[model samples]
Target: MDIDFIRGARLDDHLTIKTYISEFKKASLTFAQEIVDQEGVTIAKALVKVACIDNVKMKPRPFLRLS
Candidate 1:
């Protein structure tokens, strides 16, 4: 899936947001670990939009998460 993000922006997508948010959290954890390995705790924020592709039979909306 592809993603786009901006600060303080509202998202319209509805479906697949939960799973996408989980995956995004994992990825972010990895990144944070990379940084924390060298330094102490660091503050960071993230905004992500993931594409949710659904078949023609079902309607799907994209997913967005901010953390």
Candidate 2:
């Protein structure tokens, strides 16, 4: 996961977080995310990657079908 802090949030600030898929692969997924204040000011951004793995075999595995 890689994160960049654009601005600091104050104690009284109400924050909202949003995320979406940026890329998809057979065994991995990448995500784009952001944190914003009540007024829609961006406070931070992140790029996160996650992988599907077979724990028993200790190897990569394909993601399950959504539908």
Candidate 3:
């Protein structure tokens, strides 16, 4: 929305665009496994995707909103 953010988003988007979907999917699953182990609960795959997307957008644990 702001200049700095716009520039950052452009940078991040450029970098993100280079990522292979399969790799992202693999990493997301691996990360979700760690979260499941730490939380001691099985999380739905959709949640894992959401969490992964949120994280790539920016780390979510620090300011996680369930909705």
Candidate 4:
């Protein structure tokens, strides 16, 4: 995970978080995320990578497709 802080959020600030997939692989995904204030000013951004795994087999697995 990597994050860059563009601005600090104050205690009274109303913040919104948005996230979306930036890359999709056979068994993993990379996500892009951002934090913004009520007025739509970006305060932070992040990139996160996550792997899909089969719990029973303890191995990498392809992500399920939703209808």
Clashes of each: 0, 0, 0, 0
lDDT, candidate 3, at 36 = 25
TM-score quality measure for candidate 4: 0.82
The reply for model 4, stretches above 4 Å from the true place, is: none
lDDT of each: 0.32, 0.97, 0.28, 0.97
- Model 2 spans > 4 angstroms off: none
Q: Arrange candidates by TM-score, descending.
A: 2, 4, 1, 3
Rank by lDDT (best first): 2, 4, 1, 3
> How do the residues 1-67 of candidate 1 rate in per-residue lDDT, one tens digit apiece?
2333322222542222222243443223211111111123322233344445455845544444568
- Per-residue alpha-carbon lDDT of model 2 for 10-43, expressed as tens digits? 8988999999999999999999999999999999
lDDT of 1 at 19: 27
* TM-score pick, better of 1 and 2: 2
Deviation (Å) of 18 in candidate 3: 22
Q: Which ten residues in a row have the lowest lDDT in candidate 1?
A: 29-38
22-52 per-residue lDDT for model 3 (tens digits): 2243224322221122224422221124234
Better of 1 and 3 by lDDT: 1
Which ten contiguous residues of candidate 4 have the minimum total lDDT? Answer: 7-16
Q: Which candidate leads in TM-score?
A: 2
